[model samples]
Target: MSDKPLHPRTRAIHHGIRRSQYGEMAEALFMTQGFAYDSAEQAEARFIKAGPDEFIYARYGNPTSRMFEDRIASLEGTEDAFATASGMAAVNGALMCFAKPGDHIVSSRALFGSCLYVLDVLARFGVEVSYVDGTDLDQWRAAIRPDTRAVFFESVSNPTLEVVDIAGVAALARAVGALVVVDNVFATPVYSRAVEQGADVVVYSTTKHIDGSGRCLGGVICGTRQFVREVAEPYLKHTGAAISPFNAWLMLNGLNTLDLRVRAQTDSALALARALQDMAGVSRVVYPGLPDHPQYDLVQRQMGAGGTMIAVDVGSKAAAFAAMDRMRVFEISNNLGDAKSIVTHPATTTHSRLTPEVREGLGITPGLLRLSVGLEHADDLIDDLRQALA
Candidate 1:
């Protein structure tokens, strides 16, 4: 079974199962901080030279966490993965593991506000970081320097949903011997081929689509085994950024239906985006599935679908707020990729720390509203939006 190349859906269900003596149907949660040994000599041998499937500490590894990591890696087509306490932990770990003082990084200017702080504030302590327009090949080309250690970007950026050319940027990073790191939240793993397209590392906030129920805060960094086990695991375990066994269990359950939920939400998002495209007060609609999107061609080639998120410029902040307040079904919130529909105002919420000028540069306008479609009926959500806009 280990040598067989099963489909992703199959792997998600059975890839990392380690049955106990009881041979339970579901993966068991160890919920332990440390493991015990039979004798002093046995403990010494285990520590000195661990076997193929040995456990040292919960922070280092656990049965539940390992199951979630293995399942996600299989789904993402990566060699291995490291689960983290939260999405930001995954983001920070992925970048901090391979970077050091005097190192340089090139990244997209359009990113989640927290992600921006990680690169701009944290990385600035030692590493030199440069920001560029992710969609422009020329900007990325110019930003890559001989000293660039890595290039990072949200494959489909946050609120605004700007799609980056993963293959193109990966090519540039490869030429400069830099790793290509992608935060593939918007491009849910169901619709993502970042690895196949050349991404060296892919990060996800399992808090989002992976735990579609909004029940847990978890994240994972997926990449080659050497990078995941050797690089990410060391930083994560030492710094105490490991996901809880309970959270890992929740995420593992979430993975079982990730494909179905994301696809359903994406269908609703497409319908809603199209329904509101020419509606009154909507100045612009940004959805990769739309022909008018700047990177629609690339989106079709790379993602195969527009995805489960949509962004709209609703004329002004006042109008955007009015629409949000009027919506009965869509909840106004900052968190996304949940079972419930969520709307966010990036300029004032997620990206509020950025100056108006910087926000504008990223197309995060005062009137822009980001909609994360959920498992609601398309017509119901459309009608709610219609009444709100009316």
Candidate 2:
């Protein structure tokens, strides 16, 4: 094979295919908990220093899981990656690895409910956390400090779809020697060049677009080899947030079609956003792709497109729920980046626990509905919405 790097679509299919002597075309699933050594002396030698191809325990590493890690790492343009049991596992683990009792963490206020929970948990552990408006560089500058250990945020905020300035924040973080960690779920790996944009660590809920089918729960942490192996891996292996071999295999399968799936979904999303924008009761189209969105320029400069999700604000919560309920093509769901279109009422399902004021601040209005566009025909999806809105 040539030393030239492969395109992401090609890499997704063949990047980490470690075929066994059986010469199987599909990647082998090594469903094992522990590896046996040739002898007692060999076992001791192996424990002293495990070789690259050697395995100690499943929790520490597994072939199937490693393949998933390698494939995602290659796709993410990162030096290495660690697979986790779930997206929250990846998010919480990445933070926990470097965060200490006296350390300060500066984070964007716009966050998923679960992402907020991780920072909340850290605060109780003696870590000082400052929440800022992700879109405002001023808030980030004000909150970030000389001793800040890390700055965390979703590159694209959940439910509300706020787009953060990654390069700007990365510059702020770099000035303070703080790591810039981004949860990049909304911006799928298909279009993500977050590392190129200066994110020190990028995280994703592979459960969303990577799996594309919503088959299994998985997440991956990607960063420099030193950061992934020395920081995150040690904590993960000991604390036990490893992805299963079965799930890894599913993720492996998911990668094969990820490029195709995400692009289709994104196109469908942009189409739907346009259709919904001027509708009778719809007050706003919150998609970054819309030219009218507050962060449209940032969307163009950052991800080169609006992305796969669309958030719309209807007139009222009752109208929002009614619009969601009347949809025939889109499933009422909390999940996104799936094969089937999904519409979520954020005020009731995902962000329901937040106070009305807090929800309002994130732009997650009472009438806001988060739309995760899927692989459905654009015309049919629009027609379903048109009738529902009427």
TM-score of each: 0.97, 0.98
Candidate 1, residues 228-330, lDDT tens digits: the string is 9888888999999999989999898888888889989999999999999868888899999999999999999999999999999998999999999999999
lDDT of 2 by residue, 1-390 (tens): 889978999999999777788999988989898999899988899878887778889888888999999999999999999999999999999999989899999999999999999999999999999999999999999999999999999999998889999999999999999999999999999878889999999999999999989889999999999999999999999999999988999999999999999888889889999999778898888888899888899999999888899988887989988987888998998999999989999888888878899988888888888889989899998998898888
Which clashing pairs does model 2 show? none
How much is the lDDT of residue 75 in candidate 1? 93
* Candidate with best TM-score: 2
Clash numbers, per candidate: 0, 0
Report lDDT (CA) for all predictions.
Answer: 0.91, 0.91
In Å, residue 333's CA in model 2 sits off its true spot by 1.3
